[model samples]
Target chain A: MWLSRVDWEKIIKHLSILALVEADTARIESLARDLEKIVEMFNKIVELNIPEIVEPLYTTFFGEINLEEDVEWESMGIRELDPTGERLEDGYVKSPKTL
Target chain B: MLPPQCTQFSSISIKTLRERVREDSDFLFKYVEEVYRAIERYEQRLRAYITLRPISEVIDDIENLVKHGKLGPLGGALVAVKDNISTKGIRTTCGSKMLENYVPPYDATAVSRIKNSGGVVIGKTNMDEFAMGSTTENSAFYPTLNPWDYGRVPGGSSGGSAVAVAACEATVSLGSDTGGSIRLPAAYTGIVGLKPTYGLVSRYGLVAYGSSLDQIGPMGRCVEDVAIVLNVISGHDPRDSTSLRVNVENFEKYVVDYPLKRYRVVVLEEMVSEGIDEKVMKIFNSTLDVLAKRDVTVEFRKMPLLHYSLPTYYIIAMAEASSNLARFDGLRYGTRSEAEGKLWVDAYRKTRMTGFGEEVKRRILLGTYVLSEGLYEGYYLKAAKVRRLLHQEFTKLFREYDAALSPTSPTLPPRLGEAIVDPIKLYSLDINTVPINLAGLPAISVPGGFAEGLPVGIQIFGPPLSEGFLLNIAKLIESGRSG
Candidate 1:
């Protein structure tokens, strides 16, 4: 099963055994080599599974919206957080005359 | 007769006829041939200047002013530039080893303004290295001793400017304020310091420390002198994009036509709450009492945003400073290392190690850590979020009050070396003044009275674009001397 494949306790036990070893020169060097391999594996997981983190955030913030090309950074003022936890005025506004 | 009362030398009260004549071409050539000899006798001993304009150039300009019969507002008044400001063809050390030999190719906007107004560029005054310390003791070069005590601090960063004004070295001097640099020294030295609205004066020629927080302001013996200097420097400049677009009125107009009855001054309750020494608080209250006696209507109020000001200020300023100062990599400018057979990394590290002081290095390291990839979201970005909230709170407070008031410093000048080792205590010296800088509002520190014979200052913070109102309120304190 997918749940059984997770093996959280097995990973925790392996890390604990590594930590229990005395930090002698040999042990430290071996730990460093293992850490590098672990980091590479973690990077691969992140790269392959990026859609799981990014897609949800994009949909939530955009909500079926499109960006305006005419907008410029200099025209915007400070965007504040309102009570509803939304970015309140995007720092820039349409000129009053234009409105 | 003489030039208008405003332009006359004796009427101005700060300049000697001899000093004024340094800007007098007829006096330099036709009367006093050796002007540098005269300047040395009049202005040199105060240690008011770190660098000077050439006497040859001064003589030529003085000749022109006298020739065209051009009597500028400061026509003959001598002025000192704070060392942090770059002056074309002259070294602007900012009282540090880093810029000890760095001369600029063009004048700071303020310097150019003074020259155009026919004001003499007397010299650059001493300051804290990079305007980092409050006591001017942080100067890598030399500390500017207070003219009042000589044993005590002259206030810092802008200490040289404040001392120059208090000792009458220059009628008016320019000082830059990041976190109370102008006002604290002005208070300690018994001079007037004005930190104009953040964008009122251009920052084009200033060496950057914290671009969002630092502002150049005028320091003088009195309010009117500051007004005179501000008028010459306050107009919008195309060179500084941050400079305001609105027309700046003659600041003198505000002082002269002060409507004390129409305005309400709100004293900050937070300033008087705790840790404010008894004597200092007493003097500050007496100032309020005196204003009330004169029917000036003083109301005691508290600013909630100000409570979190000091910590928020440090996080933001240090983060910005760390980034701004990264340019001092011993490349292109400043002190370079002499380590032999050095790798590029070793040379870079060696140069920074030798050139910067402990406090500077600490801030830089903290800034680097906060800005690093992993920590930016937690520290730097969070601090900026807090800063935006503080600015909103300030805007709300200004909507109800004309200006907020507080003691310039929580305590009188601490004895030399008293809290020197404790960097946190030194950073807290800016407790009362930092919020104004964070909000980018204009504020002033006027001498309120004394605590144990040392001067104390009361601050007035005005809304953005309201320097005129801030100075006008400060005048009432300057005149009464009630405390």
Candidate 2:
């Protein structure tokens, strides 16, 4: 397996995605196995014989995005925004201390 | 006069329902009551809806429309919306505990349009969490059962919408197809599902799964109903930057006066290879025979790159998903963890850990891994290159063929637990449909035939913005079946 040589613990730490660490060992191990299988499947792309000159297709259709004129519009009311956050006090959302 | 009982609902089309409601005052209320009765009967076993609108609310909406005398094309038609699409003041759970109580302050552009066209929002249907899985089993709340057999899955992530239509819980429904979400479920439930050309429909309030790949479309029991819903939900919107500026055609007209002409259709040689269900193959072949008799010439063509679509789709879709899902941190919208003294990052982690399901975490991890340094070039970039190749191949093939036909799914509706055992197998089932999404082309899955008493769907693919052409072909096939 391609992932057999790689250290998953180190990779997880490098990414700083604490979600990976939060997963149980079995879940992480299963993820590794699944990733290896998926990567192996993706390795089949090498067999497609794509020429180096062909540019990658990032966007599906290449049409110029017609940006609307920058105009001010009525924003959502503060009361409307109140319900969508953790806590609403003095028209502000309460959050954990960053420091 | 009232239309009919809930048992006879599937036979009536949205076009007929609209006309009946307009001609008679009491027909609308009767129809709504019958639909609610059907929901009450089927919803317990089917589990199709995540949140059903009260019959009173629907009646109120209809009464207001009648009072104002402003009935649009979808007059008094009951529509089930997939929960992922935002509905103002309604809890739009994307089948995740994360958004369990999150009610949006605005309706999705499609939902707003449906209401404007005199369609009554009946309920929000169940889906795979954040539209991730093939079977509805990945939903955090509960897996929606296929209306055909309660033990089997109604293919997802739009399973509920598909079931709502199939089981006659709603007149029509809306579902978003990122990778065969709508079509797979529609196929499983014996309904018509269209994944419109990317940018054809506005994605303004759709919970972003794969932003570039996701397009919300219609699901119904027949071509006419799907086309009517499509007509109402389509057209460019300024809110969504990617919304196409092209003029929206009256898609329902194609269903009515469908031009009966010889259509050059190509069958993908790769799709019919080994591992396809024998019963599905029988239905697909017979459907081709029906098409041939209708002057739709069928020919087999080899597109070798078609085999790479699944891996390519997952790589791109997951990468986009990881980026899009970052907005669901605890401090923002959605459910927050009870973290008093924990670090902000820990709070985010705790919230996500408790909220997201296993399938969601797997995808997020895989997506993060692919986009990580060093591996990004090896996997993500190469996938993009392959995607371009697949797109080019499809583009070249369309030059000679009017449409490409294939089985919507490799197998029949799986037993509820069958797909959950193997995630990779679930991903592979999307092989036949994802290529169309990759190329941003329009495709529709029509009821091809029955297999072992279950419906099998034949998908028809057309070039970009050729929805009218695609629907006309589907309408012709549907007519050929009944005739």
Candidate 3:
């Protein structure tokens, strides 16, 4: 079934996704079409007749997760922590006014 | 004047390059120049690199290696790294506008390992934006064309790395495989790409796609060259928590003078039966004949769960991607929104909308949808259960067989602009390779043969951590092709 624009809008809002919904009509329509195909493809997973007894495999075959000791090491300064490489006046990165 | 041996890039293996460089230090510079000249000729059309280092930088690196007497196993070898793998001070765009100008402060663990082993960082190869698509068409900058046929895709998101090695632009390159990114491109470009057992190589610097499925591996013209690079990069790193604590094996040893062992190998009956291009099938059948001639028993086996791998992979991968990519909010080093007088939320919306490509946006939406409330159990959990079943099924098959073989991709490289139009068809191209990643097994795509002028690759996969064994099998086929 083709997703209507209203359905797409609902999905975007439901997911709290602003970027995909805010695109031009053509782009949004194309995305809807693509997502429809993907969703249809994903429908095959529901058809997979997996036995109920099998547990879900979340992780691959890495033997025993090793937890590191809580010893603190040399850390990146505030400047290094920032991806923009802009200097922080305090310890936090300045951003656009949210309020 | 360079020696004939040093001038030939594609024909000479990484093993030979290392030996020649160690014997004569001057050969390294001459070989690098030859690689650069090849790059200059091919880079215009192949578009293999996002960031090509200056010749002076490479020369300085070589000179330093020579002066310090620190030519490691991959000494003087020009290795093209996928742009996603961070290089200290090199722009690792990951084929995204967001990180277009983002120069990494530190080298990825794999990059550092290569440098320590004396491999020169030739350039950062192009890839799909954040490795979100099967075809390199999703790269934010531009799509990479297949070297074999300019009209066709190189098979990505490791397309550039594959093309660099295939077009003789780089001797060997590093690419990360997340659901056939390495192996599929390798198959298309007619090179050897190995996606080692997950955790065999650290993921410290690889931009996360499907974190569970991602692995940085080597791509080369031949299996031995792939093995050589694998040896240098494969090892445990404390930085990557998922890294396995195992001794790094001498993978190259398995390629040379290794006794050919008669082993039972299976071709998935389901994989070979349908959707494969006719010519690709003929090449695959011929590959089986080659293996049979090498004393390896080739048999057909059926696994019904294999059919469900594509959808299962998408669900798990996209779910993980949405979460992993959430860290890329404009606050960090990537491209931020330029809309003035906007709130942070608006900024994020604008930044992501502009920074990501169409395919990436689609995945992020799909990922968010799957992981959303009420949908998680139906989609994400069900796919996970099926994934478990696939892992169990592969484990059962491996007990009886040493390896499972199939055509790496079901079809030849899609003509440029053909695949992107139909997203599902594009995803289905990964049908043969994704199952191996879901099971987290070691798989290699060796240049099986050519079909209709495009290259066809046969995949050889074994149980987890069987990279050495898998490489040996691939080498056997590679050697047969040469001899």
Candidate 4:
């Protein structure tokens, strides 16, 4: 067996919600107040792990990619493959959602 | 004390029960009365049930089925459902006070499947608060008794479903296995149970335990009857996100072609060692002897990652369970007492304290601990890494062999009170079956033989979506008269 039975009652009582609120309410409230700060710190830790080179990589190759560079390619009259078979039809080209 | 043997009804199979109804129009009316009487007699002792509806309603459903000229494949079959599965009008308690009064407005995918196929839902079976514990003893209402011996556990959290099947209260029952909830109970009480592969069957309305590990399966006296029920219930349903988009086929068709003769099987020698009872090992070895005679090649293989499976599974499952079960506060649905004057923060605390069972609270607390600050990486994240390793090991092994076989549980069902003091011992009951859950593969527990006069089971595990092949191989072993 992986889990052993314990005196759960004893553990539950000390950690009971009533006791926590009554006794250490301020500390509990402060801990609750600091939750956002904790989340912010964790976010910072995640951001700190990002490689510096990735920022330039994201800006240069990704941002500067020109959609108009393929004007001649677009004019080749190569029809895109319609997966739903509607692009080949007369006047009614079916968007995925419409289907 | 244990309930007396069922009177007015005793030792009836699904076929015979259907035949009785067909031969005499009034037969099922009498059987319904007997079911009511039986409910009155033993419902208290077994606590195997949460509610028993009026027999008149059941008769109405049967009459409607007949009026429509619809003869169901499971005609007149009575089944006890594990409370986790939704039934439209019945209160689905999931063995916790959380949803004590929450009646589902619609049926679960499986429940609807059963009703359409001519099966009647007799009652909501007890489970481990939220299908968490190995012993049904953890149930909030009352623990289900083992029909073979009440003093012993029926094996849970599907204990009520297994006991209801074993005691002949119902012809068959459905159980969900997150970690051996189905197979372990089948082994504990002599019966056939299957945990079909992930997404093979819809999980649309099953109360979530561990989303990835949970699978709904059938329990019955023989493999064929289980297959019959599986054919009806196992299919695509758009309601569940994970439900497979595949054609449903009769599982019995797979057995007809004699596929067992050509397939290769591997038995994990290391897994069957140490923790296994001596008597169980004897029967398991004899079962292997039967297979050897049939020219079904059986060889012992070792998978080292299986050693770490238990810890990996518990960490991941509880972590998921804690998050899933958080929906059970008093406000949404279920038994909720007034924490009125207290703020909403304290209200969640008090409602959960009184409403949830000890085992439920334990898992929630443990889950909270595992996912808490500074420990999530060490516990939950590490377990996920180990689970990937376990899956990788099985994937590598499956490439070489069609399926792997092992003793479903290391020991036969322990007497009810023997291990309650030791939760770890009870949790370890899932040792063999957990690996299958962890790998997200398919497995079944067929009646292997007897260990110390109690039932033992042989578990057949295969690659994902191989329920057809797994059942065929299990049928071969189950029907082995040569042994």
Q: Best candidate, DockQ-wise?
A: 3
Candidates' DockQ values? 0.02, 0.43, 0.49, 0.02
RMSD of each: 15.3, 2.9, 3.2, 13.0
For residue B445, model 4's alpha carbon misses the true position, in angstroms, by 0.8
Q: Where does the lowest 10-residue lDDT sum fall in candidate 1 chain B?
A: B1-10
Worst 10 residues of 3 chain B by lDDT: B1-10
What lDDT score is found at residue B325 in candidate 1? 80
Model 2: fnat (fraction of native contacts): 0.38
Position B448, candidate 4: lDDT: 84
Residues B1-483, candidate 2: write the lDDT tens digits: 111223764446787887787688888888887788877776898899999988888899999998997668887788899999999999999999999988888999999999999888899999999999999999999999987778899999999999888888898999999999999998998999999999989999999998879999999888989999999999889888888888899998788534445789999889888578999999899888888777788999898878889888999998888888888876777877775555777778777878888788777777787888777876788889888888889889999988989999999999989978777788987889899888899999999878777888889988888898889889877877777
Output the worst ten-in-a-row residue range by lDDT, candidate 2 chain B. Answer: B1-10
Order of candidates by TM-score, top first?
Answer: 2, 3, 4, 1
User: What is the clash count of model 2?
Assistant: 0
Error of 2 at B430 (Å): 0.5
Candidate 4, B296-384: lDDT as tens digits? 78878877667666766777777787788787666556666666554765556666767776556656655665677776765666666
DockQ, candidate no. 3: 0.49
Candidate number with the higher DockQ (1 or 2): 2
Per-model TM values vs. the true structure: 0.76, 0.94, 0.94, 0.81
Docking class of 2: acceptable
> Model 2: residues >4 Å from true position, as ranges?
A5-21, A82-99, B1-6
| Tens digit of per-residue lDDT, candidate 1, span A1-99 | 121222423332333232221122323333334333322322322222122222111000111222235544553223321223243345443221110
